[model samples]
Target chain A: MNKQTYFKKFKNIKYPISRRGLLISFMFYSFFHFSRKLYANGEIGGPFRDRFQSFRQTFRVEPNPEEAKRIINNIIKGRDKRNNLILLNAPDIAENGNVVPINFSVNCSMNGNDYPKVVHILVLDNPFPEIAKFFFSNQSGSADLAIRIRMRQSSEVVAIAEMADGTVGEDRFFVDVTIGACS
Target chain B: MARKNYRRRLKAPLTAKKGEVITIKTMAEHTMEPGVRRDPKTGLIYPRFIIDSVIVRYNGKQIFRSRWYSGVSENPYMSFKIKVEESGLLEIEWIDDYKQSTFKRSVINVLDNNGNEIFPIRLSEPSQSENLQ
Candidate 1:
């Protein structure tokens, strides 16, 4: 549709009424539907993919093993691996970087005999990724915790849970961040 | 007045099993202004004002402590687990770079899973005295 017709058809729209605006709007409006269609057809790389590619280029943080090791050293200190009792829950693709809901839970009985001593969350690519450290005592009664954190862009999220007996448990996963919360 | 709007909401079970593990969730409302980010209009860097440390203590024993940087997102939300040793107090302290401090306290009670109070076994109990006699 022509820009004039498009604008007139959807009048009262105060902004983005030019030809470029109309095209951009049309693309933006159909991005989700088109992406869905591509997935349904078992195909990849649609119009939205191109836009995301550019976004990735601009806000990408390449995963570095060395950097992750550095972070582990800072947080976990000496012990890095122990048990697979920790869960790091995050979306495969973050629709909004501004408000990413991330939850990290340590699977250990809050019983006096066993419990998590501390839990730490780190984003591999954040400019300063040491998000937070959580300490737990017996009175806490459970080792479950949830927290929302920000990602600079697309990077790996690491969760490490250290038990009172010095047992270490951890989970790591990557998240594709679209819009950065740091901005 | 501005600081008043910045708030913290903590959710935890009022009671848990004597040794049960329960989850605690918290959400804090704050701008988390990164000192590095510049105001678009004024072109001046907004001073860094982020929660610098969060310490949680249970029954007067330190359980959790975190040191933070400005990279933390705004309105931080965190969850973690702990064992319930006994009925006691859960105290949370938050400090920011601006030297502002906030404290939040919640009372926690411990009982059996069936909701019965878990009484400690005392050596001087009446039943124990009768058995001794």
Candidate 2:
């Protein structure tokens, strides 16, 4: 039957709603109303945007481990697999941790059909752990990047590349800092 | 704004083979006070003045961007790669905590193996450079 005829025929029939059904929906709405629909990283709506906010202001005083946990959790975002698409380069034994190089690249054809939508680098132990977050459009040409970051102590660094298909690749490397950098 | 007259040096090649990945290194000499340190002279907290963001764009398309914290070393050095596409102008913008911005631009030449322009020349190499002269 056509959708129009089906709707017209159904409109003539009235079914009484049960009180239990109404109560369940009201409870469901109230439960979610207390919680904001957001990811761990505060991605409120839409694809990831290259929005910049004050990182220091997010947590005051000493480098709070709890705050870093929230930030790194947002970076990982429950993605699966430590794939080979991302290459993370770091010195196994950094003579000076003050300027350790945290470099990485995503393997993908920078075509409109598929590309890394965002690339994030996180240092697990820095006072401000998030080192870099890069948003890549098709015009980015390539996915490779290199930069210097400071590490306060021996810690694991993670690089995750989020592709347009909603899947992500992760890579982790460790740096042995001889002397602390973030004091 | 960062210290007045702070200089930015971009050490990179003006030309690259098309599709070849090349490393572009940049460094800016400026003091990045994190605001936690108390000035010896005043015995008070020094206001933070830091270059918080660095963005690199080529042919008007942004390629790489990063947020730098105060923990980043002084004279911040950033090195990264770009897959050489069509040649155009490469611009670097440095933004600080004080809303001050510094801009440096370079003419990128994406040439084929042969000495030919792979893309239309947008800007020439720096005229005063000893290499070009």
DockQ of each: 0.24, 0.24
Candidate 2, residues A1-183: lDDT per residue as tens digits? 798998999778867876798899899998665433443246563222212235333222445556666665665577775558888888999888767876787878877757888787777666566666677776666777766677778888888788888887888898899986643
Top-lDDT candidate index: 2
Give candidate 1's chain B TM-score. Answer: 0.82
Task: Provide candidate 1's TM-score on chain A.
Answer: 0.60
Q: Give the best candidate by DockQ.
A: 1
Question: Backbone clashes in each candidate structure, one number apiece?
Answer: 18, 0
Model 2 CA lDDT for position B39: 60
Q: TM-score of every model? A: 0.65, 0.69
Candidate number of the best TM-score:
2
lDDT digits (tens) for residues A39-152 of candidate 1: 534366421121121111223233455655655765565775876689888899998776777776667666675887777787777655566667666666555666667776
Error of 1 at A100 (Å): 1.4
